[model samples]
Target: MQQKGGAAPSLFRNGFLQTILLSNVLLQIGIWVRNFAILLYVSETTAKDPYAISLISVAEFAPIFVFSFIGGTFADRWRPKRTMVWCDLLSAVSVFAVLLTIHFGSWHFVYLVTFISAILSQFSQPSGMRLFKRHVPEEQLQQGMALFQSMMAIFMVLGPMLGTFVYSTFGLETSIAVMGVVFLLSALVLVRLPKDEQEPRTEEGKGQFRREFVEGFRYVWHSPVLRMLGAAFILAGLAVGVAQALGLFVVTERLGKTEEFLQYMLMVNGAAMLIGGGIVAVFAKRVAPQILLAIGMVVGAVCTILVGYSTSVPVTLVVQFVNGLVFPCIHIGISTMILQWSHASIVGRVNGVLNPMFVGMMVVSMSLAGPLKDAFSLVSIYVGSGLLFLFGALMMIPIMGHKAPEKAQAAAPAPAAVRTEP
Candidate 1:
């Protein structure tokens, strides 16, 4: 399981890895372009109506809640490469359908398109996770995941700007067409990936869909480390919910800043994430995943508290940037742990179960955040979020003392099972 001679493998040198990364970059760009274009289009058409904007968020969230687990079950049962390619092709078709609706002046169909695409993405995500688990070497798993995360970080910074520019220059119809093309390109590139070697199914896994779904839940519930991780994820979701609900008010009402300043704060944080991802890609192997999680949580809690207390724009920006910097560490640590601990056969369902826990909690937290904000001062909400983060960090402490199971280590899939480009 160790690296060959303990030297880091060159990720770019692996043709399969290169194909995945390139395809992912294009896919991400298309997603961001579509997201921002739709948001801007909605805002302008609806006169900045809050309800309309909320509908877009709901469209994105509801699919994850409803279809993620189902998607995971299918991903496990299906071929990973085929699942991913078909998902991409379906997404492109959805975009084209949206374009046709737009041509017919049925703008309401846009929401339906978004929902369908989100549903397809649920399938694609777990398929991608399964691919990473099968293909990436055990010792270099963290590095591979970190590099993938860094691409996301870069896209977060660039996507919105690019979306806005394209929308402004070409209008909605043209922008939608571009998104369709980008998705098709992503599918074509994914076709270059070799077919996955299918593993034999066990008797326990052969059954009704309901049983398979419940099995995923049971597996995670039985694993002590996974149980703790799920608790931390819920708490982290609550913290995020609090921040999302009250962040604007804290900036404008409490600190007397403008929307422009808020945008600057976001850009700074995005840039910090890009830099932090680079650090993780280079040094993630040297640190234990549990230790990395603890450090990220502690640092995030402190910075979040500082952000609440600071009145000066410069001070708030600095703390927010630092918060973003450590954020990737938390993600990389958790993802690597999931890949290492879960059996390849059920990894898709495991991811599906875990993702909804975080998102569902965020939905619950968002519901509560509004009432809590109306009752207490915004600073109070921020401080409460910091406490929640601290609680999550405390939950990680026990994990630091524990070790991965020897059986899990022995069960790790061989690299030969993962086919790369010849």
Candidate 2:
């Protein structure tokens, strides 16, 4: 139900909210253990061969670009609660399959664990979003998103440590076993979510993948908000890719510090993200999403330039900290905007369409960052990324002050519905 300038509902009181949050915690534990254990194992086996290590990343991320839309399409067709549960169960099964493969001495097949789990997540994550739409009250959506992102930020701080400790203390076999167990536990937790509403099956729904896929694109294209969001996603993706690719250089060249200092920077950022999520939650109702997103992008742009230009370690760290503080604004704003703008039936497809645009650009920019670095100064590249962020913020201006449509308006025909203003 929509709130009209009243207090929001108690988010924790919702059964779906409680269940999904618990499920996410378990998923994070599994994911981190999987990430670091596989990394350490690959490092040891390949004798730290950079190419071999890079393949792990390829296995993990390649599916998001290749299978995100496909997974999303299926997510729309399937029951969300069942889809999430099955994804986790299948992930657990895949992890154990890889564990057996490892035991049999075909250790290289370990990459299969990461690839399969990653692909399943493409399906699972969108379903989670669908569930969010189903269960979360409109009034509490931002706060709910904040709580969700804060949980992730906590993992950002602790996940690496937990993963490394599990791998180091228990060894590869136990680590993989732990990953399987946590995934199973996550699946169990998701069973507590509200049952999916049953929709009547129609013959028309059976063989319309190609048409539905096209409709997703047309849906986004017809919406002014989504079109601008897609543009912003492209810019943010490029900016983030540049930062991810050259972040080590900020420690090494800009601050003249060793690579170990990078960890401290990450910790600082993660901690700030936790606090930022809280603050955004408190103020979520007071500010519009477009404004929140624009504010974050503007801060991000400034911090990127500052971090790039700062020679002092303290200056760089402060910039990172501040950048982290506003990062959730970007995420929460984007997510809430999508939920508010899109209808429930097409939420998965919308996510699938938008996700690839971001991931695809990030991959492209990461690939380009190397050549760009060779051609230009690091500071200049950073400034260019900062400009990209600014452009992303600019894309939000037209949609500023926009609010979600009423339920009646939302239920109207797609073209007429999306084009309606608050």
**TM-score of candidate 2 on Cα atoms, chains taken together:** 0.95
lDDT of each: 0.81, 0.87
- Weakest 10 consecutive residues, lDDT, candidate 2? 412-421
Clashing pairs in 2: none
Show pairs that collide, candidate 1.
none
Candidate No. with top TM-score: 2
Q: Which tens-of-lDDT digit does each residue in 259-287 have in candidate 2? A: 88898999999999999999998999788
- Candidate 1 per-residue lDDT, tens place, 351-399, comes to 9999988888888888788799789877787888999889998998877
Highest lDDT model number: 2
Candidate 1 lands at a TM-score of 0.93
* Candidate 2 lDDT: 0.87
